[model samples]
Target: MTAAFVAGVGMTKFEKPGKREWDYPDMARESGTAALADAGLEYGQVEAAYVGYVYGDSTAGQRAVYELGLTGIPVVNVNNNCSTGSTALYLATQAVRSGQVDVALALGFEKMLPGALAAGYEDRESPLLRHLLALAELEEFAMPAAPYMFGAAGREHMRRFGSTPEQFARIAEKNHRHSAANPYAQFQDIYSLEQIQAAPMIYDPLTKLQCSPPSEGSAAAIVVSERFLDANGLRDRAVEIVGQSMVTDLASTFEAKSAITLVGADMSATAARQVYAQAGITPDQIDVIELHDCFSTNELLTYEALGLCEEGQGSTLVDADATTFGGQVVVNPSGGLISKGHPLGATGLAQCAELTWQLRGTAGDRQVQGATLALQHNIGLGGAAVVTAYRPAS
Candidate 1:
């Protein structure tokens, strides 16, 4: 297979919705311009584009990309729930790797409504309708769908394993502390574990601080083939996409009747394993990571899923400080969705942008020392997980 490289990445500082006079087009133009500038290329050089968003109407992708230029390139609109941004990235990677296009753009943005996520088309048969019904059968649908679902997963982790709510709060604390150095993060104020645990509880073990707030932001990345990189003198800045994989819900998502599986732990694990195998890499080789920490519990759960530690040992990893700076491997150096903000479509691409900067040793204050290999994990609840591995082209 041909190789694909991330030549550049850009992201907008996440903000509360309606806080600024900006619209999605403004976001698209800002982030898109930054990414192109970072790559030292013009929009005309892009052969195709994948634009992702979750809240807009049809052709939102077209309207957004038009902000970059009127270039008549193929523009594909993508929406995979929270994984929407990464889904565009996944397609962009495939486009370059498959030789479909030498230079492809992956752009993602979201101008979200404030507050918790809810389905827009309530009249229509919701994709999660059956899921809600099945969940009721499996576990008590005690709280709102998202929090309860994940909180139940955390509870099960405690019931089966020995994870504690304090451990979960500690994860949030770490992410918040990490966010203090990220200019793109939504909430950068450091919070103690006590503060995190004391924040208004969203669910049993999940606090309001643990949940990612709706955000307005955008992110973009330029993916190119080796030939294009060499031709454009971009090899020095290129970050190779050594391997990538996207996995959907497996049979255990429903058959096994476990909150952990329903919330995408299995799918994430499966995707990460495939990416590692495809790249001939291992978790121990990943010096840095940017993963889907939509909730702190998911971060802990993902630890085991990504093979960072043994199953039922995520709390132990947390205790050892193995996931933070000066630890085994730096995870979520960008503060993750928990503090960085989750703009659905933009979340994945933002992770991509952060990792690209880390691999290039340009992450500034949050730079992960000697980061040779970087891993990305992005997952959506309706079941999609995209895992990608990156290394410098040099």
Candidate 2:
């Protein structure tokens, strides 16, 4: 199939919600309007919509479209845990690529209230819900609430790979410093390595400073078919989506063998390899990346899993400043989930938005020089992983 191109992207400043103000739909509409404006298109130009949310209720997509004065666009709601935004974008990209639609919109929005965790799972009358909630609570107390699941995985990583808590803290420090330069990042405050290591421990070796905060935000992207772009005289500046892949791993904790092994490795690697082949590039050819870093160790594991570095060498890469902005490979110039704030559904599209800016050479202070190739990675609950590769207009 022909690749779809991202015509435009938009995002709101990540921040904590106030007592009363615009909610999820409001944020969604704002982002969507901005995206459409960026694409030099109108609301009517959008042929279909994929709205992603983790906790927002039914018709949330319709509500956002209503606010935008858009009607009758087939709005499909999607929830793929943390990967919701990217997953939605994947669907929209498919629609445009398959000749099903010429123009499509992918959007993600989230309004997080304090202590609101696990709100997306089903109602809690079932024993399984209770058990999961209990484990979640324990995990929350043990690690950063946002990367709770990864806490268990982190521990396992330490057990098998001798990865230290200090290594994870260093990852937090790096991203925190990166976030300080990002105006849209929720936490622009910088933290020193010492400060991060000294912060209150949420999970063993995982400190409160290492965790991502729940925030309110939205992100939207306008994707157009090559045909649509050609017809609209936009083919010259469009960023082609060269590769897209999503993979799922076993969800049960008992079934998981090792954190380092990434049960979904076959699927994720297969997807990555396919995208690389389609793009006529390899992992080394990627100049910039936006990977899911809900936790510091998660980023470390991704370094190896994504083939950015060798196995168990993620710490060395972090220590060498290889993943920092302007480094050999710039990862998460948007401050990443660690500092940028992971608004669940908004995160995946937000990653794409960041990449779009990087590729267009408009990322400002956080920009990587001559970033011709970029990658975006997102993982959902139960090991669902999505990877996408992009290249600037040739």
Candidate 3:
């Protein structure tokens, strides 16, 4: 086995669904070509590719990569729902680390519909049926499934830890402010906490602004073996992936009958523990992070899961300004899914791209000062949680 590094990263500006006339392949071509250009490598140098998209047909990965080049290399298609983007990245990094390929391309894109997310197939059984059933056993809701699950989590946090709706609204306020500086974020306008709280409610504690919207975008990264980096004199530009872990649902997911558990708090906590141990670092040592924020409630729940704060104390982190820029750790400087836009398959790589830029001191206005260590957390209910740590290449 060998070390793997993210040599280059790129992304298309996230857009409102239906705002662009482009297809998935076009989005992939733009982001993939930008990544290769960033790495100063040709598409032909990529020995393998993993492309992720949830709303596409078979061979979509091949079609998308074909727009970049017909290098005749192996292409793997991935669809892990919302975590699909990061899952592709995980596979690509593993390929380089395992010495199966000196360099690999990780690409993800999604062309989504303009409104709330819905199941693609109502006829067949849904992969998330089990997750929903778990939710049903715990509580009932007449609202949208995704929002209810997260909102219920918020409700649980409030019930257990005394967190307030205002605290969750503050999270949305902070992310919207952060997105104002992000050129690729779907929503850049900052909103007041009062305004956010006053927005049309999607679920009890979750307002429309508090939940991530359906978005369309693409993001890409080039993973290279240490040997490849040295050979190409790319070490100076590489960001080493020092630690990574992926975990799925556990017995705690449903046995506890807790919304927090059902929405992957346990998986996230388990994966983060593994990642921290693997990287030989602690949450306090992470200078920046890009965790999943599909809903603001999940962000609060993740705070405890990632060990950034104690369980039932996530609100303190928010109240103390410990998770924002110039705070203890800058989390979601990219505006996260809420504002950056959750394009499902593209989100994980988008976070990878953002963190890679931060590590490289190239994040422009949203840069976290002295960011030597970064963390990424992407989760998809069904469910999978991928946690990774990145640091400047040694």
Candidate 4:
């Protein structure tokens, strides 16, 4: 297949919209407009569109597209939990690469409500729910709520790798500080390490500070064929999508595996390896990375899983400031899901947007200098993972 290129990307500040305020369609339209403007193209130029969303009901994409003036193009709605955005982008990229379309748009939007987690299965009393609940209660004391699951993961990391709670807090503090420089980040106030540690504990080692707040936001991007890029005189500015891969594992039975043996990590690593092979770049060649840091521990483990560091050596890298903005490899310069806010479906696209900016040297204060190579990683429910490698246009 031919390689696809990212023509443009856009996102709104991750923040809460007032009650009865801007809805999902509004967010989608705004992000789509911004993406088109960034691409130096008009909305009419788009040949097809893919929208990523989890909670929104049917016709979400149609409603959003209607706001931008309908072109009667093919509009697909995708739902894949946190990996929704990346999945949509993947399909769009495939379409362009297959010569099915010249230019396609991938948009992700979410407006999450704050509350207890609910199973997305059809029947609330389904046997699947019972089985999942039993497994969650067996290994982890609490039902596998997102923040709680991450906390359990953090606790396991501590036990196995000697990762201190303070070290995890430090990750939160760093991201908060980075977010302060990002006007688009949801939480812009910098938090001290002590402040992060002092925050009320949501789940045993993971404090409130470490948890990503429920957010409402959107992100969008345009992917184009190489021929389209050359025809539009955008080759020099485009970001090359060198590699993309996705993997899935048994989610409900994850607890049966040892804490140190993360199926998600293995799946993500396989995807990353494929991406690296296709890009002809090693982990050391990556100057910037944006991984799913829904919690601090996730970020640390991701380092090892992505081959950025050896297994059990992730904390050492963090301690040495190797993943800081100016470090050997800048991770989450957009503040990540930690401080950048996680809007479910919007997050994966947000990561891609941030990486694109980094590659173009347009990340402002959070910019990583000379970021020629970048990576974006996203994980989904049931331990699915996707990794994509990118390089700046020569």
* lDDT of each residue in 1-394, candidate 1, tens digit only: 6999999899999998888789999999999999999999999999999999999999999999999999899999999999999999999999998899999999999998888887788678877666677778767777578888888889989998999999999999999999999999998999988899889999889999998888999999999999999988999988999989999989888887887888889999999999999999989888999999888999999999999988899999999999999999999998899999999999999999999999999999999999999999999988799999999999
Error of 4 at 237 (Å): 1.6
Instruction: Report the error of model 4 at residue 195, Å.
Output: 0.3
lDDT of each: 0.92, 0.80, 0.93, 0.82
Question: How many angstroms is residue 69 displaced in model 2 relative to the true structure, after the best TM-score fit?
Answer: 2.2
RMSD to truth, every model? 0.9, 3.1, 0.8, 2.3
Give the winner by lDDT: 3
| Ranking 3 against 4 by TM-score, winner | 3
Clashing residue pairs in candidate 2 (N, C-alpha, C atoms within 3 angstroms):
142-202, 142-203, 143-203
Writing each residue's lDDT as its tens digit, candidate 2 over 94-212 gives 99989999999999998887643654446555323432454553343332334555666677667767888988998898898888879989989898899999998776767888877
Question: Which residue runs of candidate 2 sit more than 4 Å off their true CA positions?
Answer: 120-148, 250-256, 260-267
What local lDDT score does residue 70 receive in model 3, on the 0 to 100 scale? 96
